[model samples]
Target: MWPLRQMLQPRHVLPIHFDNIIRINILMMQVKYCAGKNIPFFAQNGGSGWAALNLTNGIIIDILPLNKVTFNTDKTQATIGGGVSVAEAMAAGAAAGAFILTGNCDCVGALGAYLGGGYGNLMGAYGFGVDNIISFNLVNAEGELKTVTEASDPDLFWAVRGAGPNFGIVTSAVIKSYPDSNLTAWSTALVFPGEQITDVVKAVEALRPNLKPSQNVFLYLTNNNGPVILVTGFLLHATVEEGKAAFAGLYALNPVFENSGVLPYAQWNAGAASFCLREQRKPGHSVGISQLHPEQWQEIWDRYVEFRNKPGAENSVVIIEIYNLAKGRSIPSSTASWPHRDVNAQAIVIPWYTDASLDNDAIAFAQKVRNIWKSTETKSTTYINFAQGDEGLEAIYGDSLPRLQTLKRKYDPENRFNQWFNIQ
Candidate 1:
């Protein structure tokens, strides 16, 4: 047996040289070797995953070397490397006068989010990140590199889009892009008093049916120096008047603090920069809901206030992401493995602290907030990317769980890639 210290760290790491096809293929073969020896291996991306992962006595494949983003001549499609961040992709798209669907944070791994059914500001118009994937250059469990497209291999394609980490390592992917000569969005940040939680929730609910394809919004109960309820709204390709008209309900609330402006596509995720800080203990609990209940949201605000009062946990946050689902729902549900097409809102409670002693308290607080949201949900569902790992296969995979299990057996029978939300 390996020494405890050595076992705690990856056995090997080939960082800078692991970019090309030859190196990627060799890495896959090494993965197969690890599987044969009953040793574990993991692919490390932007290091944004908050799940508790066990990589002891395993190989950590640092995919950062594969960071490359290249767009086609017409700027309609771009190939994104596995290690690329959402910010990098957006920067590349902005440079090319195009837009690609990516998550809200600047530091999140592009492929990591895309594989788990990507959610972003552009999702209101373009659909989820998975919907834009043209093809994936994947190295499967058996050490074989193959190109996966809907037509090339239907089941594998479907399975990978939602549960890619469970099956293989995606070296790179070709994704659809939209060219916009004017790639700017009008965005606003609003702050409300804690007492206005019910009013804020009601405003969001009232605005839901009127949401446009170019609009999205996020509500938060968080600490900005101190506890405050915040709302961030985005409208793509819109002027100040157009944006204000679209989000009239929120404007009517008369927030205590407000900042509104137009931002380039590359700077769209700037507001989340503070939350993108790495190396802190941030265990997140999230759920999907069909409707926003004023009472439940008020309760959530109360719970957040209680938890945020904890000395070192002031940064903890409760957030609800609301998107226009018309464009995304227009696509058939069976088109991919993402199961929450019917969900109208996604909520997450992030309890952030560095003290190991606060683990139990934080977990309890997050779970309690999640329970409040779950009470309003008719079906238990969560976006895989937002899942907190203990939600079980059914919660993350939804109706796609059974079929995914079959594919897992056929492809990764020994469960080599079992780190993130493993398919059991």
Candidate 2:
């Protein structure tokens, strides 16, 4: 039986990590063995931990168990199995007195997220998740496993950083890690009543530069019975007092709620994860922008207010994240296929719909807002990680289209791994 045919039948299944290429081979052999007797089998890794999986037919190989972590004593590099979660990677890095740029959401897969240009709270300080990746152990289109690096396969390495899933399945990744220190981090939430959006915007803009490199600020617009302003920011410093002093200007805004303090790195990671916990069933879409001018903020605010007034809009959320980009853009654009290297802010408009019947209208509303933002004079770029499935490839790649396409054609002419945020 062919690989595809054996994979399609449902039979005894095994749950192993994607990094365990040997196990995958064993499972394949098992399937072949079963096929000899005309039996059917299938497997899957059903947790939300996977960043991306083969939604098409065939056996679903669970890569979560293949998690094995190792690190270099120099503190500049670490190796992680593809099945490792962002939280697991962080924990391992912390244990080694090192850290890697990762997403705030702990459940996201490390390899998949990093390869897909993952960004998170530390992005302002490091860069996209892909930037920290040094090399990868990948299973190519032909199932021949190989180690791809900047020197070994320059083009393939470049493509893998931003678009790896398109070329092949990565078994493990060797990534650059940062020194782990007891960095002081705090979260501040400011509240402004409905009519004070302009003031809030001005205050945020004013505090932008004052915010140290260790800080991340995000704006939340919601209509939970009434319009309110919530500015949540994280200040990373050597000490809690220092972080507080550095972000004093923001706290001076007299937020309705303040929860700023110091905690262990693990606790901080957990806190960050808590903020992203929302109902998964709610229809949602997100788009990131390079930057938004003050005038553009007004237009966005107006649409936000309009959406708030629409029926079934009570749970709508419009998040505007203004984080530092100096660290991320410091790397030359030519170094990787990932774009949005110079973006300073990311705007995500999420209009939630609880009723399934209202899905079409809710999606239309989200698209309309996205279109308005895309048509703006700001000329911002879209972040591939947050992009919705409906968006065209051109919209995501923008100026980087030619290079990405060239690399895509060269590495994945057949496009076997075209599952996530595909270029085509």
Residue 367, model 2: Cα distance from true site in angstroms: 2.0
Residue lDDT tens for model 2, 1-424: 0111112233334565344656656544544543455332222221332122334343444667757778887878889887787788878877877767777667667776787677776776787788888889876655556888899988888877776756766768888787856543566556666566776777777777555676778888875466677777776644667766666765666666666666555555664453344333233445665444555666666777776676666667777777777787788887888766666666766665445566566677667777665765366456666665566666566666787778777766665456556665
Give the whole-model CA lDDT for all candidates, comma-separated: 0.84, 0.64
Q: TM-score each candidate.
A: 0.95, 0.82
Over 158-237, each residue of candidate 1 has an lDDT whose tens digit, in order, gives 99989999989999999999998899999999999988889998998888777888788888898978889899899998
Off by over 4 Å in 1: 1-19
Candidate 2 worst ten-residue window by lDDT? 1-10
